[model samples]
Target: MSIPLDIAALGERAAAMIEELGAISQSPDTLTRFFLTPEHRRAADLVGRWMREAGLDVTEDALGTVRGHWHPAGEEAPRLLIGSHIDTVAEAGKYDGCMGVILAILALEAVTRVGLSRPYGIDVLAFGDEEGTRFPTTLSASAAVAGIFSPANLTMRDADGISYRDALIAYGKNPDDIPAAAYDPDKVIAYVEAHIEQGPVLEAENEPLGVVTAIAGASRLSVTVTGEAGHAGTVPMRMRHDALLGAAEMALAVERIAKADRHGMVATVGRMHIDPGSVNVIPSRVVFTVDLRSGSDTSRRDALTRFEREAHRIAAQRQLSVVISAFHEVATVPCYPDLQLRLRRSITDVDRRAVAMPSGAGHDGQAMSKLCPIGMLFVRCRGGISHNPAEFAAPLDMGLAAAALVRFIERFNLPHLENNTTGAET
Candidate 1:
């Protein structure tokens, strides 16, 4: 028998928890929790307290990831991992990564209340380093859990010149213990997460929730345009070989190529630096960064090629030398097919059609995918805004998400829904 789901109560509890966690931020006015900071330590302690209250065995790992384990099937059974990060970007919204951890706790709390029994166990993880805002590394916490963490990352430094290794030591952790944080891949079932859509797609489609099709691939490039610096007032427009002008045109080329791609593609020239910064100077050199993302790797590669050609052509026409170098690149990670079908069914059980979409934002699932099959559920937020103070999701929608996750947990045997008999027996 399915236990009755009180979405209103669930949502209210989730909202209360979110408010509590949102208060533990470094900034007095905005949320700015970073990895291994004092704010993060407080936040992790709070999460650990909640996990223990929810009837789970709470523990903190070497990287400070808080783990809440519920294992009715014994310690040797395979495990289902559900999690999201707790770190935040500067001036971040409360619901981006925090909601996922909150929803997992609520859903599992419900399961525990009913004493649901299964062949496997569940681990609710609250990772500490997804934002990558502190150190020069993102997903290091998840990478450690997935057994893909590189020791070289320990040498990476933060803005305050603190090495990641030193930060870990200061945080009361031993770097050598990180290896024990990794779970045996053979004993793991899969990883799942529930996060806000972080975009306008679900709101535009009038859906409360979405099933992520894939986490989009991303490529970052640094482009440099070199030309002669001359007196801005004396150089005639026709004779001037301005590097800024070439860069401006190249940025437009990036937009045009992305716009024309069949796959959903977005590109941005988010940062730029001009040498000999002066209002009267002609700007001899311009350096800018391009962030390109697409659901299709083939299409993303094609767009990059086209952008390179356009950059060189524009530079040649303007008599400027250009150089393009890739700094970061990650391929797309698709949701497991079986998990997708199961998650879609669970949404249908909530009486809402799940909108299938691609996540333009990066997630820890990209790292966890190396360990096991991965899936994600996206809840709709107001105005499709994220990484800002204005970010919000309706309490009822979050409640519905909790209820849907319960339904998913109830039917996690990876069999046809009709054939699955186990449920949240009340």
Candidate 2:
């Protein structure tokens, strides 16, 4: 028998869970629940209980991904995977990654309550460390499942020099057994993630739901401008070898290059440091980090190359030397067309005017898209604010997203929705 899905109840559950988890503070305004931390463990335990209450068999992988399964009775069932990361960025809002996990659980609850069963199994996964707030690597948990995480990744250290492997051991998990956490590619039929828009696109469009078409790729670069340090007051304007001035010119150049492309291209210089920053000192060294992102790889590469060239020209004009280094770079990820179509259908099934758009922010869905077909559903966030305490989403929009997800699960023939009469009751 198919279960009756209650969209309102599921959305309320998700909102409540968000409020509950948001109260666990690692900082005054920011949430710092790093992967394998006690706070993270507590959050995982809470989600596990919720999963159990929803009649799902729950387990945690070696890498700390929490899996909740609702199996159908037959052996020939395909698996439908749904979930998002539970980790948050420093000073991040409540809805970023955690909302998706909460929604997944609520979807399962609604499906079970309604006695909905499918021919395939459904799995709700709460992936760990997608934010990379403490660690340097992103998608730590999902990468493990995709068999992309290497032993080298386990050795990565946080800002405080704490190795991820040591942190796992401290949490009573074995880092050496990471291979055990990998999922068989043949077992996963599809993966879906529901997340906040994170940008103002949805809210600006006055839309409640965003059906994601693609995830923008990102490239991070660190530029260093070197010039002679001299007396600020004594040096003449023309003779001044100010590193900061050169860097400033390069920064403006980056902005211009991005503006020129204008096809969803963006560049930001979020981190900058002027050495010998004293008010009276002429800066001899200036280092800054550049973040470039675009939906097209060609555009991203073109922007990056332009920025570097402009930096070199500015340095030469100022009689300074500039060096550029790659901090990190991820290529553009195109969502699977079939999966995107499925999500669009589900969204339209719920709301006829649901809009299809590209995701500017990075997500675990992008990483998962590499291994299997992946789709994303986005709810409108207030002012599209995220990664801050003031981030928010309307309750009605949340409900709309939940309703769409539940409908998607129903239509997808997910395996976890099947009735496993022979298995012990969960």
Relative to the unseen true structure, what is the C-alpha lDDT of residue 70 in candidate 1, on a scale of 0 to 100?
95
Q: Model 2: residues >4 Å from true position, as ranges? A: 1-8, 25-30, 73-76, 157-162, 230-236, 413-426
lDDT of 1 by residue, 256-358 (tens): 9999987678999999999888999998999999999988888888899999999999999999999999999988887777888888999889856999888
Task: Give the lowest summed-lDDT range of ten residues in model 2.
Answer: 417-426
Q: What local distance difference test score does each model get?
A: 0.91, 0.81
TM-scores, each model vs. reference: 0.93, 0.88
The count of backbone overlaps in candidate 2 is: 14
Model 2, 1-57: lDDT tens digits are 334555566667678889888776667556767787887888888889989998899
Best by TM-score: 1
Residue 206, candidate 2: alpha-carbon lDDT: 86
